[model samples]
Target chain A: MTPRRSERSGPTMHDVARSAGVSQATVSLVLNDVEGSRVSAETRARVLAAVAQLGYRVNSAAKSLREGHSRLLGFIGDNVASTPFAGEIIEGAQDRAWADGHLMLIVNTGGDRDLEERGIDSLLSRQVDGIVYAAMYHRRLKVPAALREVPTVVLNAETEDGSLPAVVPDEYAGGRAATRHLIDHGHERIAFININTLESGLPAVVERERGFVDAIEDAGLKLDRTLVKRGDGDAETAYRHAARLLDRKRRPTAIFCANDRTAWGAYQAAADLGLRIPDDVSVIGFDNQTLIAAHLRPGLTTMALPFAEMGRRGVARLLAGGSGAGVDAVECPLVERGSVGDR
Target chain B: MTPRRSERSGPTMHDVARSAGVSQATVSLVLNDVEGSRVSAETRARVLAAVAQLGYRVNSAAKSLREGHSRLLGFIGDNVASTPFAGEIIEGAQDRAWADGHLMLIVNTGGDRDLEERGIDSLLSRQVDGIVYAAMYHRRLKVPAALREVPTVVLNAETEDGSLPAVVPDEYAGGRAATRHLIDHGHERIAFININTLESGLPAVVERERGFVDAIEDAGLKLDRTLVKRGDGDAETAYRHAARLLDRKRRPTAIFCANDRTAWGAYQAAADLGLRIPDDVSVIGFDNQTLIAAHLRPGLTTMALPFAEMGRRGVARLLAGGSGAGVDAVECPLVERGSVGDR
Candidate 1:
């Protein structure tokens, strides 16, 4: 273990005392703000001035030990620090935590069970005021048993048994909203390129598909099961599926893709078939990943995942003594760009 | 301010002592592992078993106060947690810190000076072993004066006056490699779509452009000033520029884009003009952002910015008592996908 370097370089209380021509004990009293220090006002001012000149800072570790509060929150996530889609989650949680005068100790465990246990142990050892256990995506998970020792809230995910407060994106509502937008655009024969659910069985895949079906039926349009193709939520897979659908003689007027990457594939498929977006074939997507959606030839219209809002709400819930056992679903707003068109 | 909740719920030392049939003082002595304590080996084993059964963790705050080491590293960044391109940087730093039995306390200030100062103050008060001050993109910056009080290293950026150690990407080499790859493929007339340097004057723009010019000169090929067009590093701007170039009577066979986004624009321009990528026009880019580069129809061939490596080296430098005032440039590896084709 490396010895702490602060002791070697940081100015000590003795340095402040010498600069102020005061006793070390008196300097400590002034710096620590001891309630009943008897130092004169002028001497206290001089000591503070010396401390500032020397750039001396109070050691919060000692203060936390005395107050029984570290004023630090621990954030443990499987891949929040590494995944491109979840950086906003950390940003929101950090912003809110800072607003409350607390800092976050973050650990990205990469979904390793042993690392997760170690991360929890580290956070517990530090005496963090609370823990925000987050997932990179919306899923059901069993939180570590150790998290029960502190105020914990799940973010972007839910506890398996629904025994913990969680903040997740309103996938069903988002799906419904996405389909409704297409219907609103007068796209009757819409093809839904759904994400594959055979392997992951993600809640997002099921809820969004359900919303697509409900919206089509509500609009009095006959559901064409053949038009719905399963993709792996990737560009290549979606591209192949999109090509097959668009190549048909009688194809849907619009395609509702599972996500932005899928939308990208559909865009390529349209290009290959000499179809202009929103003019020849309208396209919509979920998870408005700005990198792809905003930059596409015709910007993709999609549902924005409320990742940042979910993160902020997660921290807020943890700070508010944690809410009752249930999931708090945040709304995923529709971001309109150039892709959606009137059919 | 909200009080810390650990005191209300966490198991106490008294609880451990009661469970082990030992005194509170004895439990503290055993848990703290005080040097030369008189506790018998049998009693120590019993106390350890009870601690394990009750999941009683040692309070690191108290331990830090006693040992003068918090075993924590502070990571301060402008937009790391919010930007898509920089998540891997955080992952690298956090992984290294954790491997050394340390946790990272992260604060993303969103480039607010006031927030930056407060973040440094918070880390100082918490007695972090060291700090890694980072920028979202590679640039020259003046680190906060408060950072002088601790061991600090800059990541993905350099100090304006070269007064601190830093790790930045080798932009020049990456640019050279990108241009050389095209030249090697027997492309003589290559148009360079460079990022606009007048606005941001980013080092990456200047360095990458220099590398492009050097490679052209080194290969004994005349540098065509007319082939270089300035772009705002966005897809729209690149599209307009690429369209004009590709529409010319005698246009360059290959286009070297400053970055992946710029390349994305070039791709669109080619598609609109009825030109196939690498078939009608060979294209290359820099900063292989996986979101764009990997998902492009023909995966984009580009030089990847060594972001994660820079982050890892930054923490490693800070841990090794920091280095002399200079910048350590890490290599940007070339990632070959399907965008580039034989000329």
Candidate 2:
């Protein structure tokens, strides 16, 4: 017969017990740091010394069984590993879970449906008390069939059905604030560069556009239909669109980019046309992607995605005995930097 | 008495037992996917059907107890989440662990020594089979006191005492390759932009410089001491250094930047002096940070850090019954893009 893993490995609790002249149970109590055990101080110290000498590691599975809870929280994400700047969600969730005396079991599915389903099963079989489903970009997602079997919350994205509890950024508020910030800087003619949301049906795009329009109309400013445009939400595409707008006979004094990368393209366009930033044309962006935003000659003024807060709140709600069916929105705060200038 | 979590949350295996008119143990056998069980097909189907009706979730701790392994690996890191482009390490480790039927319990300590200690304790209490300690930047670190108890491997960094198994990138080899690539393109008079490592004592800086010097000397090229300049490893500082080099009576035809960001600074300096990239001066960088390298107009030619490979190998070494006391260096492959040009 094949020997079990424990038998094949190095020293065990039994070895420590033999060395310390105590029962294996006593060795376990001391190694596990169990509370209120009746073992004498000297005996506990002897067992600990034996453990240190023998390098005895308590088998986690057995310990979990004895304790009745694994104290592990499952964190499942699609494409999070490949997505840049979105890692803070995992960090925040892990930090909060650790503070609450739980470990985060992270599973990056890489957007594979089969792998995602299998990941959930594995976490469940490992007995994670709850699961946090996350996405790199905010959008509606199909619910995993196995997710309902445990306490689950969605992060950065939500189910189209709205059946599961979710924590996400308030995109509309961020858009309105960005537009308002631009207006407050004495910019009347403002152009809005939007994302090509027809392909993905992302609510952020549509809602942010609505906020832009509301801000414009609320200020009694005429909505210039010709000023609004859509791009692939990439720098290259944003550059082309920005150049066209700048080359036109009439140009806006300020522009609001859907995200920071787009704003970078707009910056490139301004450079190409020999137009100085803010002096030639002011710009505001969203998502505050620091690689682009912070490093730009004049830093970008934009809204920060509440990824950390969402992760923190998601874990908090899970520990609060939530039923896994609701949506809580986190506010995106504005970061003032060199990109924005007063007219 | 207060009801157990399973009793309060939803259906229990006992509910399936009663509905199917079979023993709860039989239900567990079928649902836990236990191997070598001899339950009849009819009874197994009935138990599964009843489980679906009652939504019975299998308790993982009990299953782990029966199997005698938690099948969980702990991943502890400092500043990994906040760092740009380091998520690949976690991805590779998580993917490998999952394929081996193991879960990775991740904890980001953000360089807090006390928090690091507590995080390790938490993972151990959850019963992780082994631990993988990682860092954002490759450097020597003080090992956590709790780590010696279990099978542990260091990723992207090594312990100061050299007592732990470690997997890290071959920065020296990478520097050689980057410099060689420049020579292969028929470039002479290559200048190496070194990082300011006076205070940090970072091995990457010292080793990379050695590789650059060795490659230049092996090519029978006289090394010019004036061509070597140190920067703060930022784009701004790099730009200043690059400008000074270009302003000299004789400028090197090509430049090797300490990193992608430094290369970006070089590119900007080239533009400021009305010099076109490759046409006037070819540039190569280290660390193919896609945000800066790939997104640049010419696309940077640089070396890729073997983060994913290191993460994968670290876990594999632990499972291979390693004693956790050696360093395994992974290769840093060169990524050739548009920046390199034939002289």
Tens digit per residue, CA lDDT, model 2, A1-343: 1113464355778899999999988987787777898989999999989877876666656665555565678898888667775578888888788777777888998899999988888787777778889888998888887887777889888888999899989888888999999899988889989877545678678878888999999989999988998988888889999998888878888889989888988988888798888887988999877777887767788888888888898888777754747789889899888877877
- Candidate lDDT scores, in order, read 0.88, 0.83
lDDT, residue A241, model 2: 91
Candidate 1 — which pairs collide? none
Q: What is the TM-score of chain A alone in each candidate?
A: 0.89, 0.88
Winning model by TM-score: 1
Q: Name the runs in model 2 displaced over 4 angstroms.
A: A1-68, A197-200, B1-4, B8-58
Per-residue lDDT, model 2, residue A157, is 83
* TM-score of candidate 2 to 2 decimals: 0.89
Which run of 10 residues does model 1 chain A get worst, by summed lDDT? Answer: A1-10
Instruction: Please state the CAPRI-style docking class of candidate 1.
Output: medium
DockQ of 2: 0.36
